[model samples]
Structure formats: C-alpha cells, structure tokens
Target: MFKLGSKSDADILKSISPSMKVLSSREAKLILRVMDECIHQIEIVSFFPSLLENPEPFTKSLGENLLRTLKEHQELEERHKCLVLDGSHDQTNSQVALSAKAVQDSFRKIVRILRGTAEALRSKETQCAEDIVKMRDGLCELREIVLERLLTSPGEEKQLREMVLEVSQSHAANQVLIDSLEKDLAMAVKDKDEEQLRSTLQQKEKALQEFVGRTQQDAEKQTHSDQKTSEGKRARLQQEASQLNSQINNLIAANREAEVELRKKKYKEETEIENVIQKYDVEMGEKQTELEEMIKMHETDQTELRELEELYDVLDVEYSQIMEERQKAQELKELQEKELEIQSKAATVIQALWRGFCTRKALKSSAKSKKAKKGKGKKKK
Candidate 1:
C-alpha cells in the first residue's frame, strides 16, 4: 500500500508567487471531475464482492485498489493545488487556494480513515465467513447423525420439536421487544428529542445484546447436555454456537457504531440549538434591561415635566400679580394729574378777583378827594 506523505498541498503552494490570476473555470471543472473519479474509485474499492467464498484475495485486491486510488487522488489534489496556487494574484485568489487546500486535506483524512475502516471490516468479515463455513460443515455432519438416529428412534424427534418450539417462542418474544423499541425510536425521532432517541437506541441495542447472550448461553447449555450422550456432537454444536455468537457480536458492534454516529449528530444539533437559545436569552436579557432603562428614563422625563409645569404655573401667577400692580400704579398717576390741574385753575381765579377789588378801591378814593376840594373853594369865594 502507498503511504500518504506528511507534506500537504498548502506546504507546496506556499512557495508559489502571488502575482498570477486564478484558474480558469474549465481547469477547475477538470480538477473537480478528477476528484469525483477518485471518490468513485474509492467507493468501488470499498464495496464487497458478492462472490466472497475466499476473502483473502478479495481483501488484498480491495486494499491494492484503495491504495492506488488514494495515491492518484493525492496526486490529482496536488496538481489542482498547484494550479490554484499558480493562479493566486489577489486576496480572493489566495483565499480560494487556501480553501482548496483545506478541502483536499480533509478529503485525504477521510479517505485514510475509510481505508483503515474498510481493511478492518474486511478482516472481520473474512473471519466471520470462515466461521460460518465451519459451522455449516458441522451442521451438515450433525444432520447426518440426526438422520441416522431418526431412522431408529422416535422420542428424539419429539425433543427436537420441543427445542424448535422453544427457540421460536424466544425469537417471537425478542421480535416483539425489538418492534416496541423501534416504535419508541420512531416516536423519539418524530418528537425530535435527541436525548430520548439516543437512550431508546441504547436500550434497544442492549436488549438485542442481552437476547443474543441468552441465546448463546442456552445453546451452550444444550451442547453441554448433549455432551453426556455424544462428545463429538457436543463439540460440533459448541463450535456452531460460538460462530453464531461471533456473528451476533459483530452485528451488535455495527449497531453500536451506527448508534454512536447518530448520537454524535444528535448531540451536535442539540448543542447548536442550545447555543441559539442561549444567544436568544442573552439578547432578551439585554433588551429587557434596555426596556427598563427606557422606562426609567421616561419616568424621569415625566417627573421633570411635572416640575417644569409647577414652575411655569408659579411664574404665571407672579406675572399676573405684577400686571395688576402696574395697572394700579397707572391709575394712581392719572388721578394725581387730575388733582394738580384742578388746584392750578382755582389759584388763577382767586388771583383775578383780588385784582378787580383793588381797582374799585382806587376809583372811590379819587372821587372823595375831588368833592372836598370843591367845598373849600366855595367857602373861600
């Protein structure tokens, strides 16, 4: 098998210059087609052939094909990476190259894991097939012995019938349990309850394992009972039972692996949902705090408005009182002006009366003096 090299496409592409344009669409499509073919080749190599009578050659062939395909895939990825790196001129081109390198690395890792798992499965299946063949041979020999015994005895046939009946009853009981578990699994899936589904699957798997173990134990007991009569028959039966037990164990392992994968997927989804819920809760908490702050601000604004209204009311009353005082002052000034005008008119009238009286007195005095002078002159004559 060709081993994958540690050096990746990123390491190789790092040495390339970053002054060239990206790859053309046609070249990119060709690289994608090569990748598709590589994937197809890997899938083909992983598939088990129907004619697996002898699995060694088939396993070897599968391994060789897988290794060859992996090598080709690695080479194709390297070429694609080179082409991408050669095309990287700008930031976008560089990002595309890096993305391609990452995808190639992840693909290589997946292919390697697939190869390993395929090899392990092949080895396990090959051993199981061999054991099945051995069991079939043993069964055939037992059948011959049974046929010979049946020809002589009839009581043994009754016991075989009873054993078959008991096995059938046990199978039926196991089937019923399996069906119930399947229903529960279906319900859990329908509800999208990952934890419940995982638990149910676990229970189902455990039940199946337990049932297989019980059947194996019963077979061993039966073989032990048969050992008292025939050692060779008991040994053959024990071998057959062991092969069946191995097959059951392999199936259980496969089921467990599938369940584990499902559990991982469910866990991932649950974690994502929880993260989303947590984010929503955080956002809600922030919004609630913001709302509370807004409410508090609104209340503060209301209180300020009330205080301003009260202040405005007090100012309005003071303005009205000042207006009333100004009106009273204007009225008083008008009354004072009227009183001054009345007093000035009265003084002018009194002065005019006094002057008239003085003129009359002067005229009377002049007349009396003229009479006195005329009498004196008559006496003298």
Candidate 2:
C-alpha cells in the first residue's frame, strides 16, 4: 500500500512537471531580484564586527567566512553579467539557451545558499553581541567583587552591594522570561501552528535582543558617569591635599621661628637675672662691711660711757668734802668775832675801876691833910 501511494505521488509529480518548469523559470527571475538583497544582507553581516569594541573569536571567524562567501557571490555575479552580455551573440542557438537556463538554475541555487548563509551570519552576529554583553556583565561583576574587597568606606560599599543585588534580581527576571518563552515555543511546536510559532519565536528573540541592547547601553552610560565623577573627586582631593601640605609647611616654619625667638628671649632674661643677682651680692657685701664698722663703734662708745660714769662719781665725792670744809670755817670765824667782843668790854670796865680808885686815893690824902689843918680852919670850908 505504501508503494502504491508512492507510485501515485510520482505520477502526480510527472503530470505537474511542465507547470513546475514554468514556475521554476518564474522563480529563477524572482531569485535574481532577491540576489542583490541577499548579497547586501551578507555585506551587512560581514561588517557587523566593526560596531563592536571587543569582538570575540567566533565573530571574527564567522566574519571571515562571510567575507569569503561574499567574494564568491561577487565572482558569480560577474560571471552572470558576462553570460547576459554574451546572450545576444548566442541568441540563435537552442543549445546556448539550455545552457543559459541551467546556469540560471545554478545561480538561483547559489543565491538561496547565500541567503541562508547570510541569515545564519546575522543570527551569529546577534548571538556574538549577546555573548560580548554577557562577558562585560561578568567583568563588571568581578570588578564589583574586587571593589567590595578593596572598599573601606561604608556608604560606597553599601551602594555596591545594592547594585549587585539589583543585577542579580534583573538576571533572575530575565531567566524567568526566557523559560516562559521557551515553554510557549514548545507549546506552539506541539500544536503545529507554524505561523504562531514563527511569530512568537521572532517576538521573543527581538525582545531579548532589545533588552540586552538596552542593558548594555545603560551600563555603559552609568560606567561613564561614574568614571567622570570619580575623576572629579580625585582631582579635588589632590588639590585639597596640596593645600593642606602647604599650610602644614607654613605652620612648621612659623613654629621653628617662634622657637628660635623664644630661645633668644629666654637667654636674655637669664643673663639679666644673673646681672641683677651679682649687683645684689655686691650691695650686700658693702652693707655687711658697714654693719661690722657700726658694731665696733658701738662697743667703743659703751666703754667711754662707763669711764665717764666713774669720773662723775669721783667728782661728786670731792664736792661733798668741799661743802663740809666751808661749813667748819664759817663756824670758826663766828667764834673769833664773839671772843674779840668779850675782850673789849672787859678792858673798858677795868679802865673805869682804875680811874675811880685813883680819885678815891687823892681825896683821902687831901682829907687827912685838911683834917690836920682844918682842925684849925675847920673846917676851912
């Protein structure tokens, strides 16, 4: 039964041969129309590495293969152009027409192969770009790890930790999206929905590609901004350090000068103090000599005072003896004056008695004579 089915299919193909030949000719023309497009796509794919900062080996190898294919395609195009030019000369020959048709058929096949190769190269280019982005992400992660190890500031370390956590979350989200897209693709394949399957696949791939591109662009922008900021901070810090060093140098110079001046002042003060002490010592020596002379003079004056006191006592005794002698002489003179007065009064009394006695003697003598005579005269009287 299978053989019969196969035989019937072959018979049906034989009946369609003429129509298929016509269709093939039309397809040939169509292929010609698309040939330039395929070549342009190949060219675009071959040039893709130019946009990359660091292309991988796979991309380089694929680009080389694309270049080789493009060169072959160009050679084939040149041959086709030559054949078209020669077609006029062979216009009368059926054999030449058959050969030309065969050549066209071969060119169509080659064009198809080049188109497939170009598509493959384009897919590879996209994949290469994705891989490069992944590698850059890995390097960034490593850099973060190294920075975490080297970082001392708590704020910067915390910022880096948060960034790492965010990157991890984003990666997880991407993984979940990929898994969901893959499941949808599996479901589409199981249902044999070619259109839906193709569209879903294209959408997923485009979304993923766009997401990767956006991620790369954002990362690059952030890295560039961070680099600019770090450079500015470093320059400012260097300027501040320079200023501080200059200020420190100035302060050190000032301190040294102040120390020198202090030392000079201290020495001058010490010298002045020593001179004052020496002057005081000289005055003290002079005062000590004067005190010693005053003490000697005081001792001599004390001895003279003792001698004067003795002389005063002797003079007092002599004055008392002279006063006693004066009293005795005055008593002697008063007694002599009284004796002289007594002698004078006795002499006057003696003289008066003598005169009376003499008178009495004379009178008696005369009375006796007169008695003799007056007995006669009798009294002569």
Candidate 3:
C-alpha cells in the first residue's frame, strides 16, 4: 500500500509471484518428458551455492542467471518439505513413467515457480522493479549527503534526488571478459582487483558525466514542452498512433507473405521436438526405472528434514541442560564468594579488637610502674 517507489512491494509480489500449480494434463506430459533432466538439474543446482560463492567459471550475467535458477529450485524444494506424504492423486498410468508422475504429484508447484522465475528473468518490468531496491540503497546515500550539507535548499534537494536516481539506474553488465593477452592471475601474483575493475568504473563514470551534462538542456526542453495544452497532446498522440498503425500494417503484410515459410519452420521445430522427446524418454525411463511409487524424492527430503529436526531437538535439550548446570555453578561460586567475604570481615573485626586490648594492657602496666616509682621517691624524702 505504501508508495515509496514506482511499484509497491505488495503490487510487485502480486505481479511476479506465481500461484499454486495444479498438475494439468499438458503440463503433466511436459513434466514426464523432462523429469530426468529436472532431477539431474536439481541435484547439480544443489551445488550452486558453491558456484555462487565462486562464479569464476561464468560471466556475471550467467552467474546472476544461475542464482535466479537456484532460488526457484530452492522454492521447489520447499514444496516437498512437508511432514506427511501427499499421495492424493489417482494412479493413472500414462506413457510417462510412474516415478515421473509421482514426482509431478509431489512437486506440482515446480512448473509454476520455474515459469514465473523464467518470465521474471525475461521481462524488463521485473528488472525495473528490482531497480527500486537499488534506488532505496541510493536513498540512504542521498540522506547521508543531505546531512553532510545542512544548508541544502529545496531546489538543490530535488536536483539531488534526480541525481541519485540517475546514478542508481541500471547499466549494462559487461565488466568481465576473458583477456587472452593478460597472464593468468592464479599463476602470477594477484594485482589489485580495483585496478582490473577500474576500466568498467571509468566507462560508467564517463557515461554518467555525459548524461548529467545533457540533462539540464533536456530538462529545459521538457519544461517548455510541458506547457502544451491538452488538445495539443491529444493531437500529437493521434499522429503518433497513425504512424504506429501504418507500421503494424506493413508488419502484418510481411507476416502474411511468410505464412508458408512459418509453416515449414513449425514442421521442422515439431520434428526436432519429437526427436528430443524420444531421446529424453529413453534417458528418463532408464534413470527412473527403479522408481515406481510416487513421491520418493519428497519422502527422501522429508526423512532428512525429520532427522535434522530430531538432531536440533537433541542439541537444544543438551544446550538447556548445560545452561542449567552453568547457572547452578554460577550460584555456587557466588555463595562461596559471599562466605569468603563474611570470613574476611569477621577476621578484620577480631584483629581490631585484639589490637585494642593489647594497647590497653600496655598502657595500664606503664601507669602502675610510674606510680610505684613516685611512692619510692616519697618514702626516700
């Protein structure tokens, strides 16, 4: 509901998020064809966390693509993490292996997640939505800049917001290219990464500076144009629509001319798809030959999840016991410390009383000796 950026989080979630997938007849067939590949890719993608840690084997774009795939895969895994097995689907036998059907039943949600993720990857609107996050980061920097310059005017602040948005705008991701000329860094001493990265930064900096230089001129033009009346805007829109309609007509005519060619292309594609399906059927059948009953994958993950939960419970109980023991030990130490303090105080008081008694005895003995000496002197007199 909050309108901080172009798309609110709730709206973006609604737009990009996939609903729960049911196993439709067409999708079920498609799943059977690609079931083996799905399992293989899922297992391989499990190691993607490591690839994400070290994406040196691929380009930045490929790395990002891999990350998106892994996230969908993780979501797919989440659907299978239930305590009870979902064996609700009727045992309908089809050309697809029984095992594949089982997997489909357990993971009916996979196709939707993958389709949604793939669609998001392809769409520019999704990318623009992602830029909102980058813009939010830029907003933090803007705040810091404003706080640094306490005397910023309203006009300056508006310009700063525009500047931040411009900076935060997504640029092309082509920083890393395999350089055959440069020696392998693994073999040689590693130079500064910034030194290698500086070229890309410099290019982007130059582009940003040029854009900033042109913006004021462009703004002045836009300001003048924005003064146009509603009638003028409607006229301009009508003219643009007319030009677009003519372009569409030309495209339609060209498409009609290519109809026969398109049919041929479609036939070829169908042949290729059938061939691939035959190959995949053989491969998938062999791999899933042992798997007859459905939800083996789900059961395996469920078992693992249960084991982990049990382990966590055991660890938690042990931790609680240790904490209890530690508390008892601490209480005992405090009790001993209090006892030692009481003993020390008692010893101090006893020593003070003993010292006072010794002083009094010495004083009384000195006074008696003085009195006896005075008596002897008086008798002599």
Predicted model with the maximum TM-score: 3
What tens digits encode model 2's per-residue C-alpha lDDT throughout 1-381?
012222345554443233222223454456444554544544543434442323353345455554554445455556655666776656555655665666566544445445544545455535335655555556556644433343324554564466556557766777788899999999978778887788999999999999999999999999999999999999999999999999999999999999999999999999999999999999999999999999899989989988998998998899888888888888888888888888888888988989999999999999899779858775546
Assess every candidate by TM-score.
0.24, 0.25, 0.26
Candidate 2 matches the true fold with a TM-score of: 0.25
RMSD to the true structure for each prediction, in A, is 40.0, 57.0, 45.9
- Tell me the whole-model lDDT of each prediction, alpha carbons only: 0.66, 0.66, 0.60
lDDT tens digits by residue: candidate 1, 256-371: 99999999999999999999999999999999999999999999999999999999999999999999999999999988889988888888887887777777888888989999
For model 2, the superposed segments whose C-alpha errors exceed 4 Å read 1-277, 341-376, 379-381
Query: Better model by lDDT, 1 or 3?
Result: 1
Worst 10 residues of 1 by lDDT: 12-21
lDDT of 3 by residue, 14-56 (tens): 4333342433456444644464444434433333344334444
TM-score of 3: 0.26
Q: Any residue pairs clashing in model 1, and if so which? A: 21-87
Greater lDDT among 2 and 3 belongs to 2
